[model samples]
Target: MGTQERLDPQAGVGTRVREPWVTVVWNDPVNLMSYVTRVFQEYFGLARHEAEARMREVHEKGRSVLSSGSREQMEIHVQAMHGYGLWATLERSDG
Candidate 1:
């Protein structure tokens, strides 16, 4: 066996190392799309069109990344989303 391989078989292999956490806003039966859009605009400072686009993405795609960062930040976003009566969660990306 080569010296490089002896260190550990996985060590020499390339892999994506960044941790990606996302604040996912889910589709809900109660909140209106317009309200969701407004909340996104208010919290994220996104324009009306941008907010609406994101909302539509959530409705069609089942979820949208409302924010992304460290676990702490994602938690805050998820909590805020809940306060607005929207379903949200934080998940670490598998990639």
Candidate 2:
């Protein structure tokens, strides 16, 4: 067994590392599509079309990445999303 393999067999050698944080909004039964779009616009200041697209993504795909940035900013976004009564979480991009 090689030294690299001995350290951790699960991780392949020379793995690319990405540490960006992302704020994800999950779909739920309560919020309407239009309301979600409006919330995105109001909170993130996204244009109508962009907000609509994100809202649709959440509606259809069950989740949408609302924003990506530093961990502090992502945490703020997650809290704001919670304030709006939306389900949300933060995760590393490389997941």
Candidate 3:
């Protein structure tokens, strides 16, 4: 089925469908790989293997998309990651 578009009165932008946003965590010198994996498991409830994989991705690739959803939700995820001492940011999902 086709997606529906709506006018956002607050932004005053033209009618458009809501786009997904993503929370990205960047590799940093401070947090260890184990810590990153644990954070992913604790905060995002990812399985151990999945969390480790994502942690490895950040370690090897510099960053990883940890979660995707509404902009507000992604913002929350980014904020929470910051609270955990992990560098994080949110952006519009490319796909």
Candidate 4:
């Protein structure tokens, strides 16, 4: 693989930069809102309110961003969500 280099003004050394990836859950007719919230709580350890909020966002907005990190982690999350029968995907975060 070819390595690209750029001078870092702050560190004065080349650093590899990678785009952040995010796990997004999409609304689906198969899953109930309470079940979605429960899954978020069980998998992510989110508080009840936080989980409910995310579920609501998915219900109203058609999608909700659940987590963000490396591409590998995001992919793992997507797979896990699929295991739970929830519609999910990962992509490079736009913001």
| Tens digits of lDDT, candidate 2, 1-28 | 0012133357645543344789999999
Give TM-scores for every candidate, taking all chains together and pairing residue i with residue i. Answer: 0.78, 0.78, 0.83, 0.84
- Global fold similarity of model 2 (TM-score): 0.78
Candidate 1, pairs of clashing residues: none
Candidate 2: stretches off by over 4 Å:
1-19
After superposition, which runs of candidate 3 have C-alpha atoms over 4 Å from their true positions?
A: 1-18
Cα RMSD (Å) between model 2 and the true structure? 7.3
Residue-level lDDT of model 4, residues 2-95, one tens digit each, is: 1246679999999766546899999999999999999999998999999999999999999999998777888899999999999999988875
lDDT of 1 at 42: 99
Q: After superposition, how far is residue 28 of candidate 3 from its true place, in Å?
A: 0.4
lDDT comparison, 2 vs 4, better candidate = 4
lDDT of 1 by residue, 1-95 (tens): 00111333557764433446888999988899999999999998999999999999989989898777767778898999999899999998654
Candidate 3 minimal-lDDT segment of 10 residues: 1-10
Q: Which has the higher lDDT value, candidate number 1 or candidate number 4?
A: 4
Native-to-model Cα distance after best TM-score fit, residue 16 in candidate 1, in Å: 12
